[model samples]
Target chain A: MRLFLLAAAVFALPVTALAQEADAPLELPPVVMSTEHPGEVAVEPYDRSNAHAGATPFEGTAMLEAFHGVEGIGRVVDAMIDLSIEDPRIAGTFVSHDMVRLRRVLKEQFAYILGAPVDYSGRDMATSHRDIGLQAADMGALVENLQIAMDREGVDFRAQNRFLAKLAPMKDDVVTR
Target chain B: MRHCQSIGVVASLIVATLAGPASAQMFDWVPESRAGGKLLLTGGVSTIEGSGGGGLATWAVTSGYGAEDGIGGNVHATYVNLPDYELRSWGAAASFWDRVEVSVARQEFDTGATGALLGLGSGFTFTQDIVGVKVKVLGDAVYDQDSWLPQVAVGVQHKSNDQGAIIAAVGGRDDEGTEVYVAATKLFLAQSLLVSGAVRWTDANQTGLLGFGGDRNDDVEPQFEGSVGYLLNRNLVVGAEYRTKPDNLGFAGEDDWFDVYAAYALNRHLSVTAAWVDLGSIATFEDQRGLYLSLQVGF
Candidate 1:
């Protein structure tokens, strides 16, 4: 009876632990050799710069105000990422990826590009998407999701297009396939 | 009994681990089968001549919502009601990989009371068929925002008019001909504007409804088409187009075509276009101006 109990306990151990892990936040533990954002997985070491945002920021705060500042930018990024992760055309690209870090970096990148008070600290576009094998169609899917997210945020259509124009040049770097 | 329990526990542990990874594998990154990915209005509306473009000018954009990894096609019907004549056309176009486009169209030019005045009976109709192919040569109009270079394409259109006797009576040299063109298109997203231009070499008189070449001019001449559009929103674009036509027939003068137009996408699969167009004159009838309406359905 004791031996059976011991075996049962052994079997229950990892299962219980896995259930707990599933309930916990998905942030991975940081690696020892890299700069880490809170609640984000460690990434390979690379020089980080605002230039990693891949586009020049607008000249004035009007664009930032149109996006409702960094807070709105955060919401937009989160919604866009969530939609894209759920979209059948593009959800596969987000699978098994470190979404926590992606959400944070995308928020920063969008805030910086919209002329908000933020600096992007992420890898450049080409380096970040190096292995994703994104085609023009994939990029188009993401853009559609982003548009929906922005529309939900009540951003003016013209303002949204102006913002998209700034990001459009990065297609060369993002669509490697 | 203890040995059995131990083995069962080992198996359960193995199952748990395998199941964890399997759940993580719920969504696999399948590399194939992506479609319907082009942005709204990026494909442009079908033209009267059966290519993708503004109402009159042929832009370099392909025919449908297909992106580089997919296929898209559409069918369109257009009608132009002029003062002295009515023109109707229906066509279909398909795009592959956003690289190649194939299209076919049929046009009917009907002269109402003007046919009786010209002594060709009342309600005379000239029918023509066009088949065209366009290949995207380089660049992307929508995505390449940093560059001034526009998306460019080369195309050929073969036209056959059915009224051979009437064409010869109008001093036409042939009832069939071929036209070649090069087109460039660009979208300035910041300015919410799109621009396109094409140069066509053709001897087709009145776009081949009156037939190809003529007694006065039997040589194909270069003609220009230009369009400029401003995007009002994601689904609406307002533009103007100008197209120069060859005056090959000695018996009648041909005039350039122009239109101020608006195109709206009801969704990715459907769109409508309306314009006020001026075709100047048809045959000996002068001041042919009226409404142009077109309907397109596709994906």
Candidate 2:
């Protein structure tokens, strides 16, 4: 039957590819269309894990609720991005970058780290910022913008600091230049 | 060649005038237009010794609002009214790249009416000048929150007193000396607390205003300075400081200093600090407690 022929071909495809890989190396393109997020571009496929969030999530739902759940996290991320793109000190760094992807990944990262019931699918810090040419002062400017966003969302100062403490260590991986 | 030299001199003069009075020709070296990216109060207020810190202790922070890429500077004036003496200090400090600090301070310690009682006449004053350089050697206190390691710095201060004859007559061995210190500071953001400690090696009596070394001690000794601060808000911090001093003078015993202070930043460019200080003993006078007030302004 035609269905049996199709199934046989589907099973044989992987065997053919494995035989080719044994004979030579596969040359994968560096960037490709993101099959997971249609509108975003992605690098060569990698595993998706909560470890990509860079910091461990808080133990309970208290931190999540303090940030007003996922909605508040989304607002803070958007505002931080908007402010950073306009801020003269670091605006140039954001130019020509994939902001669409940045916004989604950042929102997911923040929500996941704040103890939301969500997993991050973004690249690790070192991989994402490898070519940004960032400096220590650029990180400072970003933190300032983030603080402004959190302040506007009515987050308590102590709670804000607790979250900042989590992200502080990521500077080692984020500031490559 | 003479004509070309004259033209070059004229061009330099014009550029200097356009750069303003405070920073003439500085633009020639610094082309970066941006300045002041640091968070508020992160530079700390100017210390009595003109370094960045609390009232009596020198912290590991740089002296200004400059970020890691820019430059910042400040000038401060401090006055202390004590039971037996009055102390006035004024100074300026500049931080470059938030890595190195240079500062200069002048202290005038007036005997006031106590001068007459000590047979030195009224208003007899001892003056001293201190030049200091501090270089940050390790982590950052503000940003490195996840680690227990603190920001550390090492500094040297050279001090010279004007009254060498009076110092020698009072059992002091020298009027000029140098001090070296290492300071460590940390900010526990989760608790809104800051802690700083320092150890200085010196033989100065009364912080070199009464001169260095003395008949009783001529060797450099290590003394400790510590501070603890609690942040009430973004603009306000309350703290206490304790500093130990060497008892090098045979004529009078030197005691440790203590202060409880409050510092408030009105904005990025201006701040005020007030404290109740206990200087312990000066000369033969004891229980020398007083009010301390200081004002700082910068970029």
Candidate 3:
């Protein structure tokens, strides 16, 4: 039926933006199993095995350098705080707070987390914000602000996700509400 | 009447998709502990052979992007119009925790004019039902993006043909058999690419159309299926698949299956896939190539 054929149009639109006619082909990595003779599965946790002793970093620290420097960290903090307060979900919470202190503390915290050079002497995050009456929405707003800040800082998507993955674990300890 | 019914089903599906969930609440059901519906197009569309894959190969991904302890599923209807035959199938599958998946599909293979030439009644149809289950064995295809680890799974498909009498008359060994396969799938997020490979031990003739095994070869053999997918965008996937099949019945030669497809996920709830499929030959017909279209809706 003509009606059925019409559904194909969805893919036809913006044809020019799709991948090129030819794409780079993918090849399967070589097999590493029983070459001539091997054995069965005696699997254990990697950390409990001898392989754990040889832990090595596959990548370098050059990626974290983007969030380095006083100017970069300042801009990053400014973007995060500015957007966080501007977000309606969290705006009321920051109204009576000292903006200067929050900014300084956040900068120090981020610097510490990213392994940059900064001295932050604020109470631990969980203890400091425990009475703020934060909700899931507030945490979401914070993540949104952080992601937007990373984008404004020209951090590529992959790098942003990588950094976020490291920071993502803090949600459990920070959000008791 | 059946044609009208099928169309009505599709029409109702479209309405349900539009009225169901707004984009903001798409992943709201997932717990805050895990990010669900974050992976882009991880669940490849249902294949012609009634499993979750590109066109023929089965990927290790458990059919959806639902995170740990979450659930996901979809319903799909596919129609393939080839030069010598027409095929249509309806199926549904669900994945839990991205670990286990179960699916069922009913396939109709219409041997139109070719049926009369072979002394069968006009529009002779070969029908079959396929039920499949797969369990993820290892690795994370998406989250482990920085590593070379690929997700792997082992699965089984039990297929039953309705035309047992006619199938045996064509020299087929049986009308029911199970296919065992192991598949590995990997997603390279940075490169926006996905690759999958599968090895299946089967003796089904033309995927159990004429039936399983035959006078020519009765032993089970290893066949290969492979696929490569390119993420044109977060919602769009273009891929190609290749599946080498078994040649059981000496009545006709079976060629490998190939297809190039583009799958578009309008949102987390609805998707459509269209492809050009080539299932080389069937019976005495040669070059049975055609177009395939499928639609899927789910959370």
Whose TM-score is greatest here? 1
Q: Compare the candidates by lDDT and give the number of the best one.
A: 1
Deviation from truth (RMSD, Å), model 1? 14.4
Predictions in order: chain A TM-score: 0.80, 0.79, 0.61
Against the hidden reference, what TM-scores do the models get?
0.85, 0.83, 0.66
Q: What share of the true interface contacts does each candidate keep?
A: 0.78, 0.55, 0.02
Query: Can you rank all candidates by DockQ, best first?
Result: 1, 2, 3
- Judged by TM-score relative to the true structure, which candidate is superior, 1 or 3? 1
| lDDT (Cα atoms) of all candidates against the true structure | 0.85, 0.83, 0.70
Report the C-alpha lDDT of model 1 over A36-128, residue by residue, as the tens digit. 566554555678799888999999998999888888888999999989989877887876566777788889899999998788988888888
Give residue B285's error in model 1 in angstroms.
1.4
Sort the candidates on lDDT, descending order: 1, 2, 3
> Candidate 2 vs candidate 3: which has greater TM-score?
2
Candidate 1 A-chain TM? Answer: 0.80
In the range B119-193, model 1's lDDT, one tens digit per residue, is 888988888989999999999999888889999999999999989999999899999999999999999888899
Task: Please report how far candidate 3 places residue B223 from its true position, in Å.
Answer: 1.0
